[model samples]
Target: MKYSYEFYRDHLEMLRIKLPGEIELFADFIEDISIEQKADEYITKVENVLNGLYQDFEIQLNATSVLIKKDMTVLEHFYTYEEPYENEMETEEFKELMLIWKSKIPERFKKKEN
Candidate 1:
């Protein structure tokens, strides 16, 4: 099962904490499923960004590559990345609508599409 930061973030409770039981269930599932072999760069990028370890503000990930830009790259290359996600169109205008399944974007980033 692929997991995205936004997915986890969306499901996180009001206090940014996940319920132990919910997590336990996921752990059980993850432990049993054999994930496809992941590349080293993907794992490395997760470690850097998860800690806010970069001088650069942006970090991203696709299933295959870790995108990083500028001096943030360790004496290597620059170009960058974030979590696995899909684009969807819906507005918080209907926050109470219920039954929405994807993660919610912060209101501040919501904008008029060009």
Candidate 2:
């Protein structure tokens, strides 16, 4: 479940502009995973999104796997064939990747000190 992520500066910049409101939540998700008590809370949020209890974000749970994308439509091709994303990673690996990406965000986008 290890992932090889490409650190794209432009993608980070794009998220900074497009998902300004989600930045804090994303950061908190990363932080919550590191804390014992809060980890379940973070997982619950993700599960809510995956299970359709929440629909505010772009995330999909197909069978036992999860997909996070900007556009759920992009998953059509994969769904038709019941395929996992080419870039699929385990949850822990995904958390690690998020941490790396979070570190690259410019200081201005961060609402609180890490």
Candidate 3:
């Protein structure tokens, strides 16, 4: 399940960091579940922006991938992503949100349109 651009923006806000360019529009690949297979193609383009802002950011990750079952059960699959630090990241609100997001995994993040 892909999030709306606003959702992405909300998360990006928590990073308190600037990206040099536009992220690929969510509309561009909203239907591309197969994107997981070709994610390597986007690494360099995305990494160029992220790496400049964050040393621990996982540019190699296509962290958007989700596993959805017939029962509507969902699981987020991510790797090598760094946890946001309270001191270095955003506010207490952001930290609380992140912790909730991590604890709940796909449950907390399941797209409303799903």
Candidate 4:
């Protein structure tokens, strides 16, 4: 998929406009929705949800780094970024944050819980 830096910037903008708890709600929606065997509005909503997760990561990375352009498929941004500095605290904190964004999968799509 093609991910643009501007798209990521927009996603982060939504996070700043929203409270953190509401941000988590969006994250939960992404984690809960399945891409397989779905169509129409649900797929669109889930894709939007993933876009939000990508935006959160961009915001966190940009907050700590110069945000120079770099190439990485796993990221989104307005500019490419090199990896930011890391200490245990930051790593642990990022992991915690990502848990809300990326920490769910099922045995299969059919097993998805409501």
Candidate 5:
């Protein structure tokens, strides 16, 4: 697989506070809908969903840390965010804000319980 399950799981864990109680169901939703059997495809779908959250809600996600640049292979894009911070987000406070924003998922956006 291009990406291991741990990679995807780690990102999910980082976003755990944002996710609702229906996390297992959400996982199933992403995995079952993936076109590829590999776990990477499911991860891609989950990333897209998270990106959608960022865009739709103007959520301040540190997408540079979690996003996979389309058309680039995993190896090519893996460490791009590991570079020294020098832009608008260079401060530790900004990084902390990103984490807070990541966890600030709107309640309505979470998976609804039946």
Candidate 6:
């Protein structure tokens, strides 16, 4: 499956207020997937959240899909604002998307190697 996303000013502003620094963390997670081989733990985190084992965060990732449920309170407020937005992609497509997103991250937000 192919995935696409558009972020409006309001959406970004809301995210900045509601989930500060999450973008950086997300970038780190993307890098970790490649550098640290965290796919298993990433899948476990997704599974745990989906199974109600934990509520550590709103975003979840598994082998096949990426789900982002930022806020359910105002579902469908915007055409782009789908409650619990999910993208199911083949492995290659998903990896491509991750790299694309990783590339878009601002230089200051990228993780520094020791």
Backbone clashes per model, in order? 7, 0, 0, 5, 0, 0
After superposition, the stretches of candidate 6 with alpha carbons farther than 4 Å from their true spots are 5-28, 35-37, 58-114
Which digits, one per residue and each the tens of the lDDT, describe model 6 over residues 16-112? 1111221222322343344223554544554555456764334333321234222111111112243333223233443444455444444423344
Ten residues in sequence with the least summed lDDT for candidate 3: 84-93
lDDT of 3: 0.28
lDDT digits (tens) for residues 1-114 of candidate 3: 121122342342221212212222221222232333244433332343334442322212244432212222122334324432111112222223223333333332344442
Candidate 6: pairs in clash: none
Q: In order, what is each prediction's RMSD in angstroms? A: 17.7, 11.8, 16.4, 15.2, 15.5, 11.9
- TM-score of each candidate structure, all chains considered together: 0.20, 0.29, 0.20, 0.20, 0.19, 0.28
- For each candidate, what is the lDDT? 0.25, 0.36, 0.28, 0.27, 0.28, 0.35
Worst 10 residues of 6 by lDDT: 69-78
Best by lDDT: 2
Cα deviation in Å at residue 10, candidate 1?
Answer: 32
TM-score of candidate 1 relative to the true fold: 0.20
Worst 10 residues of 5 by lDDT: 56-65
Clashes of 2: 0
Residue 40 lDDT in model 2?
47
lDDT of 4 by residue, 5-79 (tens): 111112222221121421222232233333333323333333343455323222223223211112211212223
Q: Supply the TM-score for candidate 6.
A: 0.28
lDDT of 1 by residue, 18-101 (tens): 223222222211222222233233334434544567533222322212233322221111221422122211112111111122
- TM-score quality measure for candidate 3: 0.20
Runs of candidate 4 exceeding 4 Å displacement: 1-22, 25-94, 100-103, 112-114
